[model samples]
Target: MRYVLGIDGGGSKTVCILMNDARQVIGRSEAGSSNYQSIGIAATLKSIQSAICSAVTSTVKIEAICLGLAGVGRAADIENVKVLVQELQNSQLLPIIWDLQPSNIVICNDALIALVGGVGHDVGIVAAVGTGSIIFGRNHQGKTKRVGGWGYILGDEGSAYKIAIAGLQAALKSYDGREISTSLVENFKQHLSLASIEDLIEVIYRQGWKVKEIAALAPIVDLAAASGDEVANKIIDNAAEELIKATSTVINAIFSQNSGLEVITTGSVWRGSSKIHERFTASIINEFPHAKVIFPRFEPAYGAGLLALQRLTR
Candidate 1:
C-alpha cells in the first residue's frame, strides 16, 4: 500500500503522522521540534528522522512526504531538508520521493498547513496562538502570504508565549509596588511552588527555564483575567488586538479583489475560553464588516498531507 508522511514541526514539538493510500492514519509519532532556526539543521534533521522512524516501525514504501515546518521558509532550508531526505532514502531509512520540490518532498511554512485546515473550501484566514503566534491567509486562487510570525522577541504578539511573558512582567510590576492587581504575589508563589518572588530571583539568574515552560503559564493568565485581574486582562486584550491586527493585515493584503473574507481561528489560545477570542472576532467583523470568522474543521497536519496530494494531481 502506498503511504504518505506528514509532519507538523512547531517550535515546541513535532507531530508526525503516516497516512495510507486511502488517507487513513496508520502510524503516529511525536518528537521535539524540528525548527532549524531553534534546533540547528543537524538537530532538526535528526529529530525528524527519529520521528519518522518511529512512525514507520515496519518497512513500507513512502509515496510522498510533506513537512510543514517552522523556520523552513527559506529556500536554503527547504533544499537542506530535501538533501536530508535524499540521504535517508539512499540509506533505506524510509521511502523517499525520487524528485525534489513537491515530488515526494513538499516543504512549506507550518502556517501554510494551518491555513489549509480551515480555508480549504474558500479563501479565509488562520490565526494560531500556540507557543508562538502567526496569522496566515490564502485567497481562492491559492495566493498566500504571512502577516505576523516574527517570533516571541519581536512579533508573535498574540502567542501564548507573549501572554505568559507579559503576565510575568505584570507580576513583577506588582512586586515593585508599581501596579494594583490580583495577588500575583500569592498566585505566582502557588504557581511556581516557591517561597516567594525572591525564589524566582535564583531561578532566573542561574537555572533558567525553557521559553515553552514560561509560555505554559498563558492559561493561568487567562484564568486570572477571567477572575477579574486588571493586569492580566490588559495582557489578554493586547494579545487579542495583535491577533486581530494580523488577520486584518492579511485580509487587506490579499483580498484587494474582494475585501469580504472568511476567517477561521486555530491554536490552543484561540480555542480557550478567553473573552479575547470573542473581542478579536468582533473587532474583525466590525472592521472588515464582511469577514465571516469560523472554526477550523481539521488539524494543520491534515492540511499539509492534503497539500502533498495536491502536488500529485498536478
Candidate 2:
C-alpha cells in the first residue's frame, strides 16, 4: 500500500501525519518549531525528522510529502526547504527508503494549507490568527493575494501576541495611573504569579519570554473581557476591527466585495469564545454581505496530506 505524509510547520510547533490511499490516518506525531527562518535549517530539519520518524513504522512507500510551513513564501525559501528535504531523505535516520523525490514533494506557505484545510477547498480566503495573523485568498483563476502577516515586529496586528501585548501595556498603564483602573493589573499579577508590578520587568525581560509565551496571555485578556471589563472588551473590539480590515484587503485584491466568498477563520485565536471573533464576523458580513464566515473543516496538516495525494495523481 502506498502512503503520503503531510506536515504543518508553525512557529510554535510541527505536526506530521501519515495517511494511506483511502485517506485514513495511520500515524501522527508532533515536534518542536520548524520555522527555518526562526529556528535555523538544521534545527528545523531535525524537528521535522523526529516527527516523521515517529509517524512511520511500516515499510510502505511514501508516495509524496507536502509541507505547509511558515517563512516559506518566496521562491528562494521554497528552494531552501527543497534542499533540506533532500538532506532528510539522505539522512540515515529516515525510517524507510521511500519514493519521495523533490518533484513529489510540495512546499507552500502555511497560509495556503490553512485555507485549504479551513474551507476544504483551494478557493477562498483564510484569516488565520495564531501567535501571528495573516489573511490569504485565492481566486477561481488561481490569482492569490495576501495581507498582514508582517510578524510581531512590523504587524501581526490582529494576532494573539498583539492582543496580549496590548493587555500587558494596559495593565502597566493602569498601574501607573495613566488610564482608568481595570482588572487586568490584578489578572496579570495572578496569572504570572508576581509579587508586585515591579516584578513584571524581570519576567518580561530578564526571564526572556518569547512570542509563544506572550501569546499565551491572550486568554487571560479574554477572561477579563468575559467578566465585563470595559478595557478588555475594547481591546478585543479593536483587534477584531484590525482583522476585519486585513481580511477585507485580501478580498478586495482577489475577489469583488460583492462576490459570494467563503471565508475560513483558523488558528488559536478563533478556537474559543471571544468578542474578537464575533466582531470580525459581524464586520465582514457588513462589508461583504454575500460572504460566509466559517471555521476550518480540517487541520492544516490534513490539507497538506490532501495536496500530497494530488501529487500522486499528477
Candidate 3:
C-alpha cells in the first residue's frame, strides 16, 4: 500500500501527518518553526526532517510526500531544501533513494497550503495572520495573486508582529505627550525588562532589535484590548481592518462579481479571539456583502494530503 506524508511548515511550528493510500491518517508529529528565511536553512531542514520522521516512524513507510513550506518562492532555495532533506534521509540510511517530489518532497510557499486548507479547489482566497501574514488566492482560470509576506521589517501588516509594532509606536507617542493612551509604559517595561526608552534604543541600535521577540507581547496586547485599553483596542482594530483589506484586494482582483466571492480565513490570530474574528468579519462583509467566510474545515496538512490523493487519482 502506498503511503503519503504531508506537512505544513509554518513559522510558529511545523505539522506533519502520514496517510495511507486510502487516505486514513497513520501518524503525526510537530516540530519547530520552519520558515527557512527566518530561522535559517539549516534549522528549517532539521525541523522538517524531525517532523517527517516522527510522523512516519511507526507505520506506513512513506511512498510519497508533499510539503507546503515557507520561503519556497525561489527555485534555487527549493532545490537546496530538497537536497537537504534527501541528504538527511540518506545519512540515517532509512529508505531507498527516490525522486524527492514523489518520495520525499513537494516544496510550496506556505500561502498555497493555507489556501488549499480554505478551499479544496484552488479558486478562492485565504488571508491569514500569524507571527507574520500574507494573502494568497487562485481564480477559476488558474491565475493567482498574493500580497504581503515581506516579513515584519517591510510588510506583515495585520500580523502579531504588526500589532506589537503599533503598540510600541502608541506607547512611544503616549510618552511623548503626542497622544492620550492608557499607560502601556509599565507593561512595556515589564514585558521587555527595561526601565527606560534608552534601554529600548540600546536594543534597537546597539544590540540589534529582534522584532519577533517583541511580537511575543501580542497576547498581552490582546488582553489589554479586551480589558478596555483604548490604545490597545485601536491597535488591534487597525490590524483587523488591514487583514480585511488584504482579503478585499484579492477578491477584487479575481472575483469581479457584484455578489462578491468565496473568502475564508484561518490562523492562530483568528483562532484565539472571537472578538477579533467578529470585528474582522464585520469589516469583510462591508466590502463583500455576499462573501462567505468559512473556517478551515481541516488543517493545512490534511489539505496537502488530499492534494496528493488528487494527483494519485488523476
Candidate 4:
C-alpha cells in the first residue's frame, strides 16, 4: 500500500508523479518552474507543493518524495531545497501524509533522473540539450561522471541558445560583409521584422532579449539549413560534433567496455526531425558503432519517482 512521489523541476515546468510500491503509476500533475535559482525558494516550493497536492488523493500516504531539480547541483542548493521541503511538509498544505523521516526525501540534480528515465536504469549516459546542455552518466560499477553543464555564459556549446547565438552572429557577419552570404540574414530580418542590421542591436539589447528569447531564433537557422545554406549547415554540423564529443567523453570516462553503450538523448532539441538531432545521431553512431541511441522511456518526473522508490528500499 506504500506510495512514493517523484518530482522533476525544470527551468520552465515542474512535474510530479505518484507511484505505488508495485511500480504502478497512480497520478501525475504539473506546475510552473520550481528552479530555486531563477524563481526563488518560496516560489519553487510553491510550485513543487502544488504539483504534489494535485497528483494524489488526500488519504494517500507517501513513503518517500524524490525531487530531481534544475539548479540543484551544489551541496548548498540541496541543503536549501531540503529545508524548503521540510517547511512545506510541516505546513500541512499537501494532500497526503508523509510517512517517513526527513531523510526519506531525496533531492538531486535533474540530469540524474533524466539519465535514469532515458535508459530505464541507473547505468548509462544522458545527453540532454535544451536552452542549456549537460551530459550525465553512471557506469555499472556505480561510478558517475558529468561534463559540459557550464550554463549559457561559459559553456552550453551545443544547446539551442548556442545554436541561436551562432546563427545571429553569422547573420550579422554576412550583413557586414565578413562572412558568406546566406538566407539567414533575410530570415532574421523577416522573422523579427527588422528593417536593417542596425535594428538588431536595439531589438536584442535595448528590447531586453535574454537566453530564451535568443534561443527562439534557432529554428530560423534550421530553416536556412533545410534550404541548402552551407553556412547554416556548417553551424548545425559543428554543434552536433560538440554534443557528440561531450557524450563520448562521458562514455569513455565511465564505461570502458567496448560493447554497445546505452546513450539516451533527452530534451526538445533531440526530439522529432532536426538537422542537429540527425547529425548528432549519425556522428555518435559513427564514433561508437555499437552505440544504441534512444529516447527516454518515461519523462524525468517518473524517473524521479523511481529514484524515490530506490531511496525507500535503500
TM-scores for all predictions:
0.87, 0.92, 0.85, 0.96
Per-residue C-alpha lDDT of model 1 across residues 165-273, encoded as one tens digit per residue: 8887788888888888565557777988988777877666568876777788888888888888778888889998888877888888888734677787887788656
Question: Across residues 122-218, which tens digit of lDDT does each residue of candidate 4 receive?
Answer: 7888999888999999887889899989999999988889988999999899989999898988899999999996689999999999999998788
Per-residue C-alpha lDDT of model 2 across residues 1-314, encoded as one tens digit per residue: 57999999987789999988787789989999999998899999999999998888765678899999998888999989998888877888767777886678999999998888777768899998988999999998989999998999999987999999999999999899998999999999998999997788999999999998999999988889878998988888888889888998898888986779899998788764666777888889988999999988888988888888877877
Identify the leading candidate in terms of TM-score.
4
Which rank order by lDDT, best down to worst?
2, 4, 1, 3
TM-score, prediction 1: 0.87
The true-structure Cα RMSD of candidate 1 reads 2.8
Candidate 4 — which pairs collide? none
Candidate 3 — worst ten consecutive residues by lDDT sum? 94-103
The TM-score of candidate 3 is 0.85
RMSD, one per candidate, in order? 2.8, 2.0, 3.1, 1.3
lDDT of 1 at 48: 81
TM value for model 2: 0.92
**What tens-digit string does per-residue lDDT give for candidate 3 at 49-145?**
7887787665335556677887788889788777766766575633323433443456777787777766765567888788788888888787898
Error of 1 at 4 (Å): 3.2
Q: Which stretches of candidate 2 lie over 4 Å from their true place?
A: 95-97, 100-102
Comparing 3 with 4 on lDDT, the higher-scoring candidate is 4
Ranking by TM-score: 4, 2, 1, 3
Q: Rate the local accuracy (lDDT) of all candidates.
A: 0.77, 0.88, 0.75, 0.86
